[model samples]
Target chain A: MNAGRPTGTRLHWWWVVGAAVVLVAAIIAGVMIGAVRLSPSQVVGSMLDRLPFVDLDTGLTVRQEAIVWQIRMPRVILAVVVGSMLSAAGAAYQGVFRNPLADPYLLGAGAGAGLGATLAIAYGPNTGDWLVDPIPLAAFAGALIGVSFAYLLGYTVRSGRTSVTLILAGVAVAAFLTALQTFIQQRESETLREVYGWILGSLNTAGWAEVRLVAPYVVVGLGVVFAGRRLLDVLSVGDTDASTLGVRPGRIRLVIVIFATLGTAAVVAVTGLIGFVGIIVPHTVRLLTSASYRVIVPLSILLGGAFLVLADIIARTAVAPAEIPIGVVTAIFGAPFFAMILRTSKAVVS
Target chain B: MSTVRFEKVSVDYGAGPVVSDVSLGAIAGEWLAIVGPNGAGKSSLLRTAVAAVEFTGSVMVDGRLTTTLTDKERARLVAYVSQRPRYPQGMAVFDYVLLGRTPYMGTLASESTHDIALVWEALSALRLEAFASRDVATLSGGETQRVSLARVIAQRAAILVLDEATASLDVSAQHEVLEVIDALRSSHNITVVSAIHDLTAAAQFCNSVAIMDRGLLVNHGAPVDVLTESVLQEVFDPSIRVLEVNGDPVIVSLRSEEAYQ
Candidate 1:
């Protein structure tokens, strides 16, 4: 019954190229196949025209240009950042906890971010002011605070301060924060539309401002996670064994959690809680490829970007002028795809 | 040319000490088996060598105190096998064995060619060349034990600690596993400290024995000198006997009914 590509000798070189191609293809599809369609040459010439020292007029109207650059490009880039962070964070969580089912939000960061966004919307002095959008910043702070509280509670209640206790602490923290958020959301009935839209999650309102806000965190966080790939692999053997191998298990877990939560909070501030991408993309990579974090982590970054862009395509197009929440779209498309992978690809996942 | 010495060693899991005031030593190039009934703290005592568990008192490796050694430095001296080592799902046998090279690798760098070469050497030594690419989850229990040993071999540690590593294997597989370990032990002049429940196997395979009871070290010496019928009866409640087979003393416990007679 054990049938899979020997995960040890991962088909490393070829899949790196393969994921690149998939990303390129997914990016192309994301750019080209939107509602107000532009021809391939027009899109290419427009992109080329924007580059310095390469000014050529591929006749495009101001409106189409706005549609391409202002609307589509920012959404796609945000998708890339959010998707990459969630997937990589998910991989790190699973490795540190040594549990395959672990997800990025296992530490209550997402719920904390959700509460932060709600508070900014409900209680901030200028709810109507778009010039200084406090939601993203507040959400980032709340996420870190939330995880800190969970870590503290886990440390206090746990006799040994094990990984499982941390997960349980996250669950307890998430429930409390979500309840508090719901209470506030209900009281602030005036901004219900904004609150609902934010909670449901959407990239339709994405702009260069939102992308600019989260880009640096995404870049730095992913870099730290990449550097920690081998250590994460060692951690898969569990914390005690990892310490025996000379790396401090507690320190590594803290560093990874801190950096990953930073990136995840940044994205959640803008995108809300885009659920399934964090948990599913890494798992899909594992089932199709290898259990080694070396393979899974990098692939998660690539494929997560691709998967979200594809899901966004459906989210925007499925019912024209009535946008579906990006979070819901991820599950609708991802769940069945994951099931198919589980059935057809008999890789030893656990 | 190394010796592992434990002095006034005591391990407590907050409730009480599992291994209390146990002074033990294993000379270089020797196999020392720790034996006792369940809850005798044999595993806890063995775990002290690898620093896997927290313990009071001092453990010294080749005259260097354990507390003074860094984690990687201690790893280079000791390799440990659990009662049941986990084979991560879908991990190839080669990858699991390659984990042994973690101590030698820098944080950012992957395995070097030399690290890979040692993995191959260890695999071939254990006759696991063909299984290198196979999924570790697919291996039989005996093969899994051997794979763990191969990983330890790749580590190239001077001291080996096994906590009933072959407890789940069949009778023939147990003997085979012990023989392979002994062969590697003598060839490389490695020191071994194992906790085994099988008294006969411990007597037959180990150069010396240490008997523990209720977290205390009760006896320590050569197997023949320490495993006498009278000595064992004092520790074990049941009727026990020492039999002579090819001049080796083998310990066995009789049934309750036979004990009364």
Candidate 2:
């Protein structure tokens, strides 16, 4: 036992610092090593030139500038934002449910997004421009609708919004939504490949607009979750104990679910249903740090961003010129890691 | 000087009242033990003080009606430790105890230095300082009970409501825990209201005892007055015998005559 402070608290700060350093290194690597390999100086010079008041000339050609700015940068940024959102949302879900197996998609967000994307591809007006894409908006609406329907079902059945009932409701809602999506896909076989590709999850079409679309929701949602960290800790003691400790566990759980769903829905809307990051990042963070939400939430954000960026790098480089879907990459590694966690760690869903 | 009073408190779970018209009070610095057999509503009555379950009548903490107070205000006045409370996996003992300081923290803030110091004090009080960094999920039944007690001690509330807080502990650990609580009541004047199953331990530790049967308060007074042989026979078992041991009541259950035959 360390004097002056709890050992968990001391070690958490070190994890945060280490995660931050790794994230920065991953970002630099993501910028430099892409389809077109650029030197470190070229990547740095291009980024500096794009900064508001900086006019640095490193004699890089226009093609090089477009490759760095227009292609790689937006994809990297989108990966970071999406990964952070999913992992933080997962951490919040686990805390609220008091189950480590709980993930962001436990509330039917993925199925809803799938249905929304299917509908958009099947019947949405053909717009050639990527900026005016209707898939993300439709997917976002569908995700919200799916989660709301599940919440309403759970609320009506239990009258108390207990976590177990809510999860069961979500499972039912997801199955129904997936069946509807399948029917839609069958009716419009022309868009089958498009729907399947989107469902498999890819970051190939990522651009600045997708980044802008998801930023505000992720920022606000993360803020809400961070603010409720202490309450989450109290909630883990069970509802009655939390109530006696001055926390309204029901209200805190609801607020956390809403914000986590919103952030997760926003990212899944653009990135498609990227699996594993949500479950893997938060669980890994808990292993590295204590189970306290105060440490888990921030570290989830940092390490999650780095994990996805690294995954994307491998997705693109492993079979170069023919990029593998990112969801496949995450599952390839996440499945074994998750199984190992279940076998060895006692700090899982209880 | 904080007092907890229940004015005709009744709790219902849709069918009917589990605890009916129960009126009780615990004075400042008093150790009052509520004793009864299973389904006697002892736990329900204790829970009413913390508003854990919805109740019909009023519970006043210190002079204010508990219904009128905010959750935070009510929490600052009373802390409840439930029987068999759930522990989060991988939570450290120190962190679990520090959660008791939730009432004292701001909405977006963490525990203060003073709060951490109180947690340390609580841990040391229960002799749990050595296990401060250990995972709560990894503790034994008795150690977990002590950790639960340490958490409420860190809460620093004027009144503590424990629902069978020591049911899991062995004989010696139970004595050690009750000793710590007795020390707290005398030195800090903290009022403790616990739902206890062990009659002899309750008689030894508590200054006053309340007897309940079938959702009603049958009798309440000093332990010697309430825990009589006749009352034990009626409320618990017909074969129970109450004897005096060092001026405190000790209850023993005699084997039935049919079993001997």
Candidate 3:
């Protein structure tokens, strides 16, 4: 065999560092530029004082501390966690399906969550308890059911299970569930506003509780996805090719879909339906680096978190006292970027 | 040094068996070609050796039953190259070839320097060094075919199972690919079993040829013996003439009666 020069192995430390720096800057900007504007020093000082063994006196008053710590910090952290989860899920979905256009919501997760939240608003007991947040709980259950149904439908349609058939099944299930959600809204028109608000997606109601609720799922799910990154690359080579390489494409795809769905459903349950973060972040990472999932998955988490935090800042401050849905801002920017990607890259879309 | 053996192997995809009781072998460092008309179960028989389809009886690689081996162990012993392999968008040719190291690397571990060196060697041997950075999606038909072979080369397996590996290549590219495989077979003492449609190419390259018809292996011997005019006419149902040019058989198809004036 002819021995050529060793090819360059990817060194993505720069990409990781760049994304982390941007995330830190976005967090600082998110905390400082809210309605009750706090200076950069105040934000840093308050944060440092909260750290263990660092009780440095902050120049801010008690009300300002509450606004910074209680209000903005939790929202910023929730944005980071939820954004990372959604974008990572999107990357995994695209890899598993072997389709560039696939997103976290490709398998009826969005429609299922919508129906769940709608049902909660229409018939669930009216309560103000954070522990018993019926909307999120129902939405989580609904998302799981929706995906399960899609998988079953895909399985039944043919003896051999292919990704194309599964995606088509997901589209069918999403359409059916979406119609049912709309019908429920029509029956109880009073719940229309609440359902529409949740579907539109927002970070306005973010709190420390939401952050704590989603952090564990995001961490565990991301760990599974990160470990399977190389396998994802193997899988992108098609089932027959992957099999010849000693990889079980069916088993790996199932594991990836389960973990990605769990993380996506948990976050979508809480954050409603945030669009474009999953597709946009992963696509941007692919454009900058190679299409190896090893780089795409991790970078998506870091860059996605930063992207959502920045979008949230605009969502709240773009029209002070009245917030635009976080989804709207992402779609506004992401749609155009997605169009540009399609126009510029001649790579295989499938 | 590995030899592939199939004894009474049968495969079925719900609608009865597509390949039945087919037995064959490719000794170490030799090339075996299976030639047949379409729907003659040639591809299915090839797939049976790799465990890609559910099959009965036994397929032995180097005297060990393939069914008894784990997927990784089997992959280490044998590598498969499909006729048309899928390529991911934006995947560099280097990365695509490096995937052949999958059986050797741990689940979570990335490719090491040694693994990457093997990939570079395979690419260079195939004259694919210039296309290393190019996207697999952007490769020409012949180049894509070579890249597929390069991936199998990177696997470093002792035996190769190829299904119509050069069906899409032009005559010149076909000869180049076969020459590369010939060189590798001699250097590495590797065994190759290919299912090809080109009878002339098979007679030129392979030491042995197996003819199949209606899911059964009908004949197996030296290429000159098995690729006779009668066998080709019977199996392929084509009116063809086999001529010996410099001791090599060259197949020529005659026009049908309806087309003749």
- Give me the candidate number with maximum lDDT: 3
The best candidate in terms of DockQ: 2
**Mind sharing the TM-score for model 1?**
0.96
Off by over 4 Å in 1: A1-8, A48-59, B258-261
List model 3 lDDT by residue over A1-350, tens digit each. Answer: 33455363374688889989999888988899976888888888888898999998889998998888899999999999989988999999999998888998899988999999999989888847555789999999899889999988987885788888899999999999999999999999988888899999988889998888877888888888888989999998888879878988888988888888899888988899999899989888887777888889999999899999999998988888899999999998778877887678755344
Candidate 1 recovers what fraction of true contacts? 0.66
All candidates: DockQ: 0.57, 0.70, 0.64
State TM-scores per candidate. 0.96, 0.95, 0.96
Q: How well does chain A score by TM in each candidate? A: 0.92, 0.92, 0.94
Q: Name every residue pair that clashes in candidate 3.
A: none
Off by over 4 Å in 2: A1-12, A49-55, A127-131, A337-350
Question: Residues A1-350, candidate 2, lDDT per residue (tens digit)?
Answer: 33655633543557878999988778879988976788878777777787899999967788887887788889998999988989999989989988777888888898999999999999998846656688988889999999999888988984565778889999999999999999999999999999998988888989998899899999988888878777788889988899999888888888999999999899988889899898899888787566888888889899889988988998899999898999999899777976787678656545
lDDT of 1 by residue, B1-261 (tens): 888999999999988999999999999999999999899999888878878789999999989998898888888888888888878888889998999888888888898778888888888889998898888888999999999999889888999989998899999999999999999999889999999988899989999999999999999999999998987998886489899899898788777885568
lDDT of each: 0.86, 0.87, 0.88
Docking class of 2: medium
